[model samples]
Target: MKATTARGTIEAGDVGEGRPVVLLHALALSGRLFDPIAAEWAPRRRVITPDARGHGGSDWDGRPFTGEDMADDVAALIETLVGGPADVIGMSMGGSTAVLLAQRRPDLVARLVLADATADYGPDRVQTWAERAEKAVNVPREKQVDFQIDRWFSPSFVEANADEVRRVCDIFVVTDSAAHAAACHALGTVAAVGELGTISAPTLVMVGDEDYATPPAMAEQLAAGIPDSRLEVLTATRHLSLIQRPDVWPEIEKHLDA
Candidate 1:
């Protein structure tokens, strides 16, 4: 389905019933990436998954997108669709968006799950991200997928999950270069660690021990900054731990219940 937000229109997959739980996806992926996790939660709570602008069925405004803009889109979705505050679980870019959402509209977020996200990439890493953005925008689409998969998953996992890797690559192939470029810029520009102290919602910062993009060290800093927060490290997983390790859901479930 689609929801009209103040910024533009967003495509979403809303399922189940009861307390609302919104799942945000990473860059170059759509709401469909949450199918496995959403199905698990659907039996107990309402799971809302929305494609970030320019990624899926959502409309792209033909401008560079920001953390604030993406955050507003989620806030608007919660307001118009869920009709109230909702628990949010976001990974990668979505995780950054969730952090911004809690910072900008604490009233709209009941609980927060920041998976593989960072509050700040700092000057050095931000520069690195900018360089990556430049390369991503110029590289051939196939090489782009190869570059991203190398960073997003561990080598062994990639070797073992060819079909899954190809499925994800398909999504990356269709992603608008403009939108992807904008998302990369947003990551480099985000510096919200100081603001994280003001977030009042109970937060869980989870990261894969093997995640190089947003490593456990970053998650440690993120958990430390938030007053009511804890950090969990999933072993043997890379950037996309939720997809890499479904066994971790029990731990996530326990955290959500708390």
Candidate 2:
């Protein structure tokens, strides 16, 4: 779970014991966000969820970063641990990093699951995200919690599972805003779409029906680009579908187990 980095020893919480699978988390969130979902992938498959560079417990180098840089790190993680290729699942911004890894070093990615991610983060989206991050930095932590809930969860889900939703929001508020802005910039100039079809991985593009962040349209766009890929939509869920709707894992399990 720990890898020696040029900067320091980076840690990733790993579990399960089958084919190696790497879990990349979303923007404004750390790898710990995957713990709940990681359980389903474990006990049968080896799942390694790392705190993305500059997020979670990982030391920030104070360097401006990009998704491509994160992708390069992941490709190396796979090569070092698995000795070659491995299946990768990325959620939200993590999905962008996943694709970048596959495209830049196809030999390191065996299969890809892009969940709640979009290829083109246009100017508008980047600006909005950047503005939001800017607004969040100076605001009190309490307000940041409210903002995350509104953007990432459905009202009904939050009402029914307020405590659980709060924990997810807590993670968001404590995350470094600057790191998020850097990732936003990375996605804004993202260019991995062209080589998607070249990916040999048996891929799955997943989204939640109630996901407001990246809707079904985005998932469909991914399926169209990744040759022979399939799409799975989790119902009655929001942006964090994997955590909000537990049923989503069976499909993911099927993908990994297959």
Whole-model Cα lDDT of every candidate shown, in order = 0.86, 0.77
Best TM-score among the predictions, by candidate number: 1
lDDT of 2 by residue, 1-258 (tens): 578654355568778888888988887788788888777668778888887776777766767676688888777677666778888999888898887887788888877888888776654866766676566456766667776677677788889988788677777777777666666666666756667777777888888888878788888877888886899887766677667767667878788667
Q: How big is the positional error of residue 110 in model 1, measured in Å on the Cα after superposition?
A: 0.7
Candidate 2, superposed: residue stretches over 4 Å from native: 6-9, 123-126
Tens-digit lDDT track of model 1 for 47-89: 8999998888999877876788889989998988977899999
- Indicate which candidate wins on lDDT: 1
Off by over 4 Å in 1: none
Candidate 1, position 173, lDDT? 85
